[model samples]
Target: NCGTWFLGRLQTERDVARVLDGLEGAASAAGNALDRSEIGTLLAGLRSRVFLMNNAHEEGHLLFHTRWAMSYLRGPLTRKQIKLLSPSAPEASGDAPKPAKSAVPTSKSSRPVVPAGIEEVFFSSEPGTYRPYLAADVTLHYLRASHGLDSWEKHVILAPLEEEAPWASAELLDRGDVDFSDDAPGVAEFVAPPAGSVGTARFRSYGKQIRTHLYQARPMSLWRCKSLKLQSKPGESKSEFASRVQLAAREERDAGVEKLRARFAKRIQSMEERRRRAEARVDREKSQYEQQKLQTGISMGATVLGAIFGRGGFGRATTAARGAGRVAREREDVQRAEEELRDIEEAIQALEIEVEEEARAYLAEREDKAAELEEVVVRPRKSDIAVMGLKLAWKPD
Candidate 1:
């Protein structure tokens, strides 16, 4: 019977061999392409990792985790080497998925949603490693505090922290809920389980799966994102009174500019009419003078006899008086036209200057905030697990 122990150990070694075969294939399948010698090194590294389990469990696998697990097992966290966790290198065949689109930030902070709306607003933050930008920051600073991530972790995601809903039957889960504790599930518990362990002791270990799902919070993409909020009345949460006010202000200002332009046009038209009337009177006076010259073609001797009589010679004098009056009126009309044109031109120049000055002032206000806006992006970041997105956690009223 003692000699038959070889048969039992033979089956165990066979299982071990099967696991190695799978690991080898997976390691080579990556685009990085692990060689046979590299596969041997990978196995060695996996075996050498220290398992920090409690007294309850020790059912370990030869390759229970992905490639990232090896990196996690290795020591001190470095911010420079942070990246999204991926099992394989990006494929050259275009099968690999692209990273989600991120919101492009510019030198402006108070961004216009469409130059007339508001969604997210950003300020500034202290520089350094944080969240999505710093992948290892979560593992090293958060997960490594106890090295507690498990192979089969649970997720119960909900909406971000906000006002309590009208029909919420329960309070929103807090950080204290999923926070790592002795009672909370950990990778160590998976390594070892307490006696009287029910179905898969690791999964049931102090309800870690349930707890992880409870406090799940979706991280924000922006390093410095602030919610754009409006002041509300006692009973109204969705009212957009503030935005309405903003829209009204823009309409009024634009309308005023149009009114000024109309007034300027009318003044110029009146000056043009006065100039035309003066030109018409000047033409009539010139015609009368020409008719007088034709009638007086008779002679100077006849003119001398008429001059003594004082009636015939006075006809030429009357034409001259009327021409002089017409000339004077035309000169006044010309001066009026020039003055009106100058007034219109000055008004246009002033309007142009006002627009430029206003633009300069607005840009100056954003100048102080530019340094922070350039470094970060603010895209819509919701929990990937929450497919429908953060819904009304409580039953709708």
Candidate 2:
């Protein structure tokens, strides 16, 4: 009799009701063959089994096309709808008998209530949970192969849920109880990092939390990509490698700056030496000019006294002319020395300005170089790589 039963797709409540009606009619046709109680029992069993089978089939179908189905559904099926569709769903109506109350006080809070004896788990973001489908393996494999990411043992992908499903909350997709291991054969597990963990900051940066849902999958748009590369040394974690690369870059930048400073310091020192020499020459010339001036004063006085006393007119005249000429020559020498000193000071100032400009240019160059260095050496974390894979999964073949 079970083998004679026809199985057809039951996608809607009307479809299920129609099927039940057909079964009831068939039972009625057996006049006096079956009693009322027997008929009720038979219909109940058939309805229960049929609903169970339908729910299982629908779940499997959703799982196989997890990402696509989520995109289409936009949000999880409402509890009322699920209850109507799933025969095993708990009754919520007042007519249904209430379960026995526990000793714990029940609050009317919006937070989910945990059953007694079960540990309550909290997520930093809402746990947007989804069931893994059969096609997940194939999708991951295709991602790994297409992206040339065979070296990584595992990946965790992050994609923006807001873009694909606007009604869905911004949250990390919850990979419920999925354990990720390096030895595992699949590309990655859909597990969330524990709250307050090292890489959890990366997740929070996106400002999305997962909402509790029966069906979930990675979004199509990639939010971030993380991956590991061939380690420079043995037993290096991705975090450690990133730190090392950053340290090396900082060291390189510092070394370059120091070298530039040292080079400029040498040039400045040479200019300072020239400035000192010029100052010394100016001082020496000043002293010589003063002496020459004093000598000329004394010679002129002597010449005036000699001429006034009529001791020697031509000799006094010659001495006065010589004194005047010597004084003028000393004054010219002092002026040249002072001019040289001014030129040296200006040159030193100019050199200082040049050093500052060059230093600024050098720093800018190092900043650009540091960015390039990060791009070249730094690799993303496992979650980032997983996000990339998720993005790749949605790409057309």
Candidate 3:
């Protein structure tokens, strides 16, 4: 009886073996060869992963495997590796069926239905005015000390927040919402939720996510990006910082002109190289065309000689002359094609040269500007000034 106790474990092992056998059968049917040892390894791997579950509600054993688990057991899969015969693992083939698309309701009369597991919350600073929007799992990060729920009203423009909405059940008392001044510490603080109101206080964690989303969604045009660099101090105005930043950026840009000039020079050189190659190719084709024309002329000379000799050769000679003339014409046509190619290439070169010269001039101007900037902005050392003063003192003046 004691020896038979180990037999119970065989059932679990057998179940795992059966699953492997099914996989092996499928592989065989598909003409995929699998060795017996590999099948045994697969079974053993699945069995080894099994764990017993014990709880107050129930007690049983469960088997679980994952991408990481399979990778750990069988080593990493590489492009070079091929599966001769394999088990039906999700990762082996990305052929899992996708969920069907849900149909959107067409009728305007349909009530707004929030998705399952999502919640719609409304909060307002003013009485009788509430705004509603959907959020997914708002409390997910609330347990942590540094995390809390963020009021959606801050970032999201709720329908009620708009200037007009006739159907809105809630109305805010104050129409004059404060606008945060630019170059200021807190434009958002004016719109801040009334103190002790649910709209004001937020869970730090959710608030961080909401703020991140708002910042990301904000219009990110080049002008907006440049305008975003406000003064570090709260008291400083945004316009003041904006002007300083603009001037500094202009100065930096002026200094970078030398690099731009080098870029233009390199581009011009590359364009010239390409032009040469295209011209050479066109020349080679033209030479082939000339050879063809010469061959045709030689044929015509023989035909003319045959015609002068008379007898049975006259008719053939005339036909041959006509063919030769056509060939020469075609050769001329080839020459014309080459000329067109040359013209096109020259046009391209002219355009490229124009572009390069313009770019060079632009860069040179910027470089000159930069040189001026260096002279004006980069102050000379005190030692140099002192030396200059001594030289002046020693002079006749």
Computed on alpha carbons, the lDDT of every model, listed in order, comes to 0.32, 0.43, 0.37
How many angstroms is residue 144 displaced in model 1 relative to the true structure, after the best TM-score fit?
Answer: 21
- For model 1, how many clashes? 9
| lDDT (Cα, tens digit) per residue for candidate 2, span 75-141 | 7788899888687856589887778532232122212211122122222222333211111111121
Question: Cα lDDT for residue 240, model 2?
Answer: 63
Q: Score candidate 2 by TM-score against the native.
A: 0.40
Candidate 1 lDDT (Cα, whole model)?
0.32
Off by over 4 Å in 2: 1-250, 371-397
lDDT of 2 at 49: 22
**Lowest-scoring 10 consecutive residues by lDDT in candidate 3?**
388-397
Q: On residues 1-397, what C-alpha lDDT tens digit does candidate 1 reach at each position?
A: 1111010111232343454465445444432232333222222222222211111112112222222343346665466544433345754777757885232322111211111111111111322211100000011011211112112222323322122221132223332343221121111111111111112222233234323333343221112211212122222222243343344444544565565556566655665565565556556555655554444443444555668888677765555556556556655655665565566556556665765566555445433332222112222212222111111111111
TM-score, model 1 to reference = 0.24
Best by TM-score: 2
Off by over 4 Å in 3: 1-281, 371-397
For every candidate, C-alpha RMSD to the true structure in Å: 27.0, 19.9, 39.0
lDDT of 1 at 302: 55
